[model samples]
Target: MGAATAAALVLSGCSSPYDGAASTDGRSPGAPGTAAPSRPAVTPTATAHPPNDAVGRQMSWMLGQMNTDPVSSDVSSRFTEQFQAEVPPAQWLVMLGQLRAQAPWVLESVTSDGKAGSASVVAQGRRYSLTMTVDDAGRIDGALLKEGAQGETATTWPQVEQRAQLAAPQVSILAATVGDDGSLEVVHRSGEQGVRPIASMFKLYVLAAVAEQVRDGALSWDQQLRLTAQDKTLPSGTLQERPDGTAVTVREAADLMIRISDNTATDLLMRAVGEDTVRAAAARAGATHPEGITPFLTPRQMFWLGYGDAPQALDARAKWAAADAQTRAQLLEQVPMPGPGPENIDMTSTPWRSGVGWFATPQEVVQAHLYLDTLAGDAALAPLREILTKNGGIAVPDWSEQAFKGGSDSGVIALSFLAPPPQGTQRRQALVMIGTGERPVDEETFVAATADAARLLSEHR
Candidate 1:
């Protein structure tokens, strides 16, 4: 319910949104696709491709094939039969047409790790990020297309804001140069300082609370914690499936919580640090809405609040609305919330916009990252850096010392990053905070837009 998929941090490329956040290889593409029956059938042989511009040529070739009827060779000549089986040539063209993607696709560049690769391409005025799987014979296997980067010889801050709004009707984006003293010098921003739902990104505060505990000697990273049935929340992580008594270290839980958006791990930390502790951490991180996060709703409460017991005698919707912060705390402790089971859950609903999650301003999120950045670099808080750097979300490896925490629910998505600014900028860090909601943010389009934003921040000097 927090993040939709496992978020794998691809060192030099983008991982599939389906990949788990902690896994290094979960983003690997499946075996090459098979040919559609209409095409001239030929076996796709594996060919070794060294890290070179050859990947760009192959991407260009594949893009060139999209304009044809029945996709010359029905794309059988270019892709494996297995790959073609799911998406035939006609459907491919139709999907591209929906995006209004123009033809004569030009390959901007490709990053290959020998086995998998990410290609950036431009056509007309639109940019695309493609995760292409090339078999050993250099045959195409599987591909995931990310849409939304604007087509421009160069991107400007204004256009970045324009593209951000396209991703969500309600959007907030603010980029800043972080000072060593923890102040933010605003560089670019589009939205007001309004508090907005931040979905699982709230886990960052929970993480901060955990780090605070470690620093105060109340908690230790290597300290063992056990997961009970009551502690389990829902997925966007695998921890929910473990046995009730499963034991994990504080560091291990924090890793899963950040890397995979582990709801269970988040709740465990909240338990360890207490909601009051997290509230203090949130205040320190510059949260805009103190009331919204004071109790720090867990995924279980979020899911329950999201799917309120409308028809039942214990209507959480009405009672929760009338309750004060103190009463809300009581409700959390006394109210019967949903468990990990699938029954009675309505994930299809849009509870995020109703503010059932973390609340922060785009600027405040930058503050949050700044605070985290400081902790990450500290000797006592070293685990914080490793946890955050584990998944740098929308990959743009050019950004030095990239650390990220992004969150999403049905109708909300937040992407925040902290890293050193471009050379000669003389800034401690380049911070990006974006939040979009009111409807489900398109993962592909939003991801592309984010990548473009990071790429443009390089010119911040």
Candidate 2:
């Protein structure tokens, strides 16, 4: 995922909507403002080329716009029509603000294959890469700023693990290779049995359940479902913005749920497939603690349960937990929908406590992935693999196919990857990392550690 999209996800509470209240502007409370600094001239590297000059100029201009009033109409004029449409001015400004908050960057070099180009830059005393595609009109059609090679070398798994062990309440990792015979072999594991809050990763079980129904001819991928006012969820998706009765296909809902961790899409799918069905699927997948998800709470319910004032919130949770699916659904109908306002609830203050959020061990997560693999042939499973591509931040060049699912909320981070080995290699592999603490887990550090660990497994396999 791009940094902007990832930031948006984090801000939206994908790990668990109960974390913190979102501001009216769609940012967390006290999010940094979009004030820009004065524009500065581009600093050319010692060996700057023509392509370098062109991209550097654009980069310099972009930085200037970001530094000064990014939301202004003048800054919006620089982007292509498609870019502007996809990213609104407010969102674009937020993204720019985040980039500026990172260390200032200086253009180093640019490389292109005629049609597309990439620029190297130094930031925070480390090198990073920015990629862009220029249209025939010389307007930027796509752009991405990502950690460069040097950033990867500066951190290692041991370093990250040590830091996590010290700073985090708990850290769990699991790596395994799928044999030709379809059995999984544990290659490495630490706290594999430790259970932690896995935020959106819980959606995988929901996906598996839906897949089984499709396989059994009980559900159709093309089946359309309508949205209601009650179906709207918080950020991380567009469904909440659509009007009532907006029809969407089962495939589309599933896609949105996995790709963006759409809370509304998740609830829609849960409602369509039946809550009991998802719970059954969890049992089949070997989830060690299915009760954690019993009487599954949609994002809205989670918010109310976690953020509603103390005594009332506790009473609601107790009643909801005691009720069956039928009664729980009725209770949900009475729950007030979330809206913009100051939030008194804060999940980050105590990350170790599991409230209404999803919880599972690394082994259960692996089991869920393994079960999904067994149903890969089912037509319903097809879109899932495709949607998962959005979450593959760690690139494994040799892997022919990679599917990923990640989750985070205030103080929790979870990542899962399913990669089929390259041609001539018969093994499939899965890697999972789960972290929890009072302090938020550093995304870049966690991603690098997971990537490095996966790399080691791939090389030795």
Candidate 3:
């Protein structure tokens, strides 16, 4: 559920001379009284100046491209030739599209460090720090956009939990570690057993089912499926950008769904494997409220259900939920699809509380990951482990093997990680972080707390 942004990497070969002023003893060269014979006034060597405005100019061009044709070759021209060669324009456009979906990112400030600089950008009520490097010609060579650090100093697990509770009174956080021996240990928790909205973390169950089918020979890893227009969902994926009828193997789809949390991929895979399979998987995984996602939703469907304005939409959803399997299938065919643009859904309100999304408890969430790990042995789970490494946002250096899946929508945010014990140790560990409230949770604070929780668990282990 996280929107991805494009970052530019620049390699510049330029240096600026220091602007130190040269001084002579204020005494006249010849004598106090003699106007020193006018020698050619030494023209101060023109100081080579740093490209202080390079970041500003490059950002201006980037903003313009974002406003105009972000997908065009012209937009790619803003980047250095080498950069464009290294990264495809289509990939750039995909990232730009995600940014466009969350527009009005205002420039806060820019600070320079030699040829490199960092820009603070604010959008969607959050601040991100974008770092960029310029080439000698001033073309943007590289840039990266990520969440801005909240200036708060680091604190211990107890302090983080207390502050998180105060900052988000409605959020219930749970932090626990499970050793290799399968011992579940609670480190810090509040409202740990509450069934709060888990956003995309529910996909773990769907993934488990898919893996099970592969193991049972019910589905082949190489089975190819077409991407019809109807299967397309919103951001956090590349599938939507692909042309209709594009073919992808079952294994590829599952990787995208879990690695990037692609909505369209999830929907297509769910449809392909059958929703009943995923439901049963969730139940087997120890989900306390599998019914919360009984009628699993694609990203598009979730948006329509949570934000669509048509009155009958809610009625249809209600009937679908209450209907039997056959009747629900019939009603699902009649469900409305949302148009592409800003949604009318009031995110600040408790839309999730209306039961339009998925929900699960902390222990259940952890159990789901552990269940999947057990069900899919090392060889079968290799692909899952491979893709999970792409999750650079949540990586911790000390852990030998780490896998993560996180979700966020409006007032809900959930992060789950499975880290195996260090070499020569039999203990493996899992960490789950959940936050929800009537209002939107502060992403910076929540992320910091999660990092602290992970560090604490690692230290204790």
Candidate 4:
């Protein structure tokens, strides 16, 4: 799950549509209304982290807690009672005990004792060293502390930030805001802002075009389309084997295109809206990466959109042998090609279906998302959002939330999402992460950096 998806769960008043209101283990959302069960009283555990880590940046703030005497549980209970005017004796006892167990620890000592500000502590069964410093206002204003043989150093925070920047040199972020008055602020942009080819993110435009068709009364949302063998683009996405007679509704095709990134469905949808119309829609939405498609669709997009054009007469036989059985069958059945079919066949081989040489900048992809958002409440747009909200083909953490479209090419991975802070604070912002690496960028690194960035911004907001 990404932060955006996680925030969506927080906002939806449930973890997910499939999951009930309670946690998987059945924990309720609201605080226990009755007297809370008591657990063993815990001493303040010395929280340890890397110097450049998140906790390191806030060490100064934690240190400030030592300045004022740690308040007792009785005081906390009294404050709660004062605010509530009636805490009920049972609740008061629970809160009082909680406050007592979790007071801030004083910065007893620093290990290296240098400007970097490292310190060590023995709490519970573990011992940890301090990393960085934060002021009374929770601002990161100090260097990280050094570490010993084991555990975190103060420099952990900066190191993570440095690693994140290096991993994702380019990023495009997209965000949406629905103000108190229902005014929407949707922004789509890239990190540097120039010509960038948006791959699967272009589906947003396809969805928009579908919505326009719906508006014009040319297509019904429930109308069904057939998926023949020709549509199968395999290995990664869902353009696998299918009978020529297989039928899918327009809505179903839309669902597959966005949810599972079905390439064949995209092609069918493109046919409905016309490739030119789709490009025009993107252009209208201010996408700088939009371009005219070649007369022939590339193998990758063919896999992405779910279908491929027929091969020329001379090479049809050779192309047929190379394609999967289902894909070959589709070619034989539906594709309009000139060449004869191939001689030898190998059904087991699966080629990399990276699609045509399409390119998109992070900013343009974000703008594409912005365009899709503009079609809010439209019937055609509704299902696409549902698919994005339900499952983005990418594998993100279950803890983070995201309703997004993801696209990846040889050197680029692009995504645009509007996500709130995981803590669910007052802050509402969007994130666009684009990574182009000499080697394939690590997904974990991208996710962590994006999460950290969202968290940092949320706290500041």
Candidate 5:
């Protein structure tokens, strides 16, 4: 409704962002960046003096993406294979194009600490914030451009609750004070007990299930898993388009699943670990409402239920919705899933509103984040941290430990964050918000809640 959040947010896939706490000179109904669009293509802009460090190099690369600079190998070389796959070439093009077209963006200055940097740019005729981060290997983790002032004030808790409430017709938020020992004390709760459809945020539980196998010796991260016809679900990821029989390591699938919300990778991992483990994952993570989340549906099943034109698809969905958990699980195997191509799936409708997909309360998801974070502390399960942090959804300044996952369907959007307070902030924080209605999810509320969450965690509230 204001700036170009609908366009700017799309650049950072809905899954996560390594940086950018989120700023919008405008507001709109759709969840900016979370519900993904098919990768689009475009060119980049040029900057004379991008910084002189890792983050600076990324600035040059990203600036190149916005400007019409001659294409270079910097894309593949500057980013990890995982990063490249996560964002895809088309997304880079379109997202950069959106950032470019949002307004006349001029790089005013850049600040980098060798690992991470912030580039202050003037966009929409106003000075805005754009940040870039890189790993130890100097690979691009993420870049974010948003409307932020240099010394912006922290948002208050009531403001945070109000922002969270604007998400949808039924909005639920769970905010807690996170302890250094991975403990979460309830700080505030607004409809936190209500179960709402979580969309792809369900992948967190799926990740936990896989981690259990890896930890128990039943699975190995590097162990190879082959793609098959059954695994092809849909996007929010790129793996579905890969030819059948393509082999991928379990770790690769997990990375893709969490980082990009790769539906196909999620299905693969879910299959690898089985529904039982995921159910167990919910319980272990302290899910108080088991019936609300059980009978997990793969992305393919989800797609087929909402978009499938097959004769039985509609009826199956109705029966699936009415049946008990055990029967619904049986129906999943007995039913044939035949959904339309990606182009035909209607994105503006709320198919999941009828309770066709994974559902969880904000409180449960918050606990799940703590549970997953606890698992991440284990030496053998160390990879879990990398998987979760692959795409720190909202980019908060100086946050060293950001594990993010956000999901959205037509009318549903859910974002979960669990990270120790950023540098100079001692309070650990965890937040999960779920919004649902009859249209696309709202982005403005998320922006406010995210800003407030950062402030809440930074200070002793």
Candidate 6:
């Protein structure tokens, strides 16, 4: 609530010659770059500096607002702009309270001197630095924070190695790697390796399943088919309302399912592949929850199925033995589906039907990519990657060589990429990010998280 409490006790010792301890014209020190004389005084300026009162109150209000929940982008941006335009001189406590309250789930510690300050915040389960400086007033003069590490924390051999071994939150990255020998590899999860629902990421498996049929002569990408009522299941990809009674090729369906994430197209492909086959393929690829289509069942369907079969389907469950009820429910319910068939189809309509909603660890995600790559080589991986790497309607050039898949269900977000390293680069990287919380999943956060993770892996390679 006060600057003294927010700042570290005994803040005076942390100083340097450039820290400005004197004043000019025989007055006590007041501003930067002034060679003023020093004087022992009891009362300092109540406001910090520059645009003092306005800035302090603004920060105070920002900190107060954060007690409700994490600050939304709109809230953060508004405060950021206002604070910058009208900064305070000595409102360091306001900064501490604001950062801590705004990201309570992430921030760890905060400390400040009159000049420079630092705070520790957790992101993706790893600690990161947020450093800033204050002018004579308590407004932020400068600030710096990165999604990754600043430097090694330890000087000792084992400590340094251990620090190096630590994984950032973004390490859940999934990607494809091309080696020096032209061989492709995938690296999925980097830390706390655990199995997570792939959601739409499982669509890659559906794509691979279809590709397998193509390789075995059971199906052809160019083959055409009718959009029957049976194909109107929930979560169906591009198989939505196409020209009614119009015909389209299997390749086109695959393209829309992978590229546009079309739900109806996904449903048709699923029916073609059969739920059993898709589950089998997913299991072979090490998917932990291979119930596949079952996870996308409606609540009533889940009730009828006893909720024990596809634990990932229902968005809420009161299990006799478990704590991840919300997560399990989110994993199950968030999957997309299409409308029911015309034969009295009464179940909840899924946005993307033929798609997969199975749970897989980030490693399983990489393995899924590998399974597909092994079958049709780069060709099968291409279309999906093109759409996913676009980062939501915007094209990114570096992603041209990247073939990947992305999935989102409620609070869960997943991405699996298989791409060539930039020209002349050898090692490949897999980046996966899985977020399961009550917080709304923003697409920009996903893209930024993935990009940051990929950059981290690239730097080490």
Index of the highest-TM-score prediction: 2
Q: Write the per-residue lDDT of candidate 4 for residues 180-266, one digit (tens) a residue.
A: 333335533335545443445666677777777776787777987776554544332344455676777788777766665555677
> On residues 45-155, what C-alpha lDDT tens digit does candidate 5 reach at each position?
334467678788778767765556655534677776766777787656555555556644567777789888887665544445577778888987765565433222337
Worst 10 residues of 1 by lDDT: 1-10
- Pitting candidate 1 against candidate 5, the one with the higher lDDT is 5
Q: What is the per-residue lDDT of model 1 for residues 107-156, given as tens digits with 9 covering 90 to 100?
A: 56567765577766544444545676767777677666543233232277
Models, CA RMSD each:
9.1, 7.0, 16.1, 17.8, 7.8, 17.1
TM-score, candidate 2, is 0.74
lDDT of 2 by residue, 237-271 (tens): 56777878999898888887776677778878888
lDDT of 3 by residue, 1-461 (tens): 23422321112211100000000001111111211111122222222222447766676666555545444556444678877775567767766776666666666666675567776666666556667787887777776655454435346766667545533555565666676655687766766567877877888888888888877888777889888887777645667788889998888898777666777788778888887898888888888775677577666777666656576566755665456556645555665784431244455555576676787888888888788777656575556666554454354566755767777665666777778774454566677777776665545456666777777666664
Which pairs of residues have clashing backbones in candidate 3?
8-142, 8-143, 9-141, 9-142, 10-141, 10-142, 180-427, 180-428
Candidate 3 lowest-lDDT run of ten: 16-25
Q: What C-alpha lDDT values do all the predictions have?
A: 0.62, 0.62, 0.62, 0.43, 0.67, 0.44
Runs with alpha carbons beyond 4 Å of true place in candidate 4: 1-161, 165-191, 289-356, 379-381, 392-402, 420-428, 457-460
State the local distance difference test value for candidate 3.
0.62
Off by over 4 Å in 1: 1-130, 134-154, 308-314, 318-323, 330-335, 341-348
- Displacement of the residue 1 alpha carbon in candidate 3, Å: 21
TM-score of 5: 0.68
Each candidate structure's count of clashing pairs: 18, 4, 8, 59, 19, 64
Q: Across residues 1-461, which tens digit of lDDT does each residue of candidate 6 receive?
A: 32221221111212111000000001111111111111122221122222224333333343344334343334323333444444332343354453453343234555555466555544323333445554554544455442323234443333322332232222243344656443436433344456554556666667777777776778877777777664654322335556555686777777766655555677677777776676666666556654433443322222222222233333233331132434444544443333242222212222122232355677677767656656554564344444334333213344445555665433344555665454446565555555443322332234444555555445444
- The parts of candidate 3 lying over 4 Å away from their true place are 1-78, 81-128, 133-141, 144-151, 162-167, 316-334, 338-346, 422-426
**Model 2 segments more than 4 A misplaced:** 1-53, 64-77, 86-133, 143-169, 180-182, 309-311, 314-335, 338-352, 379-393
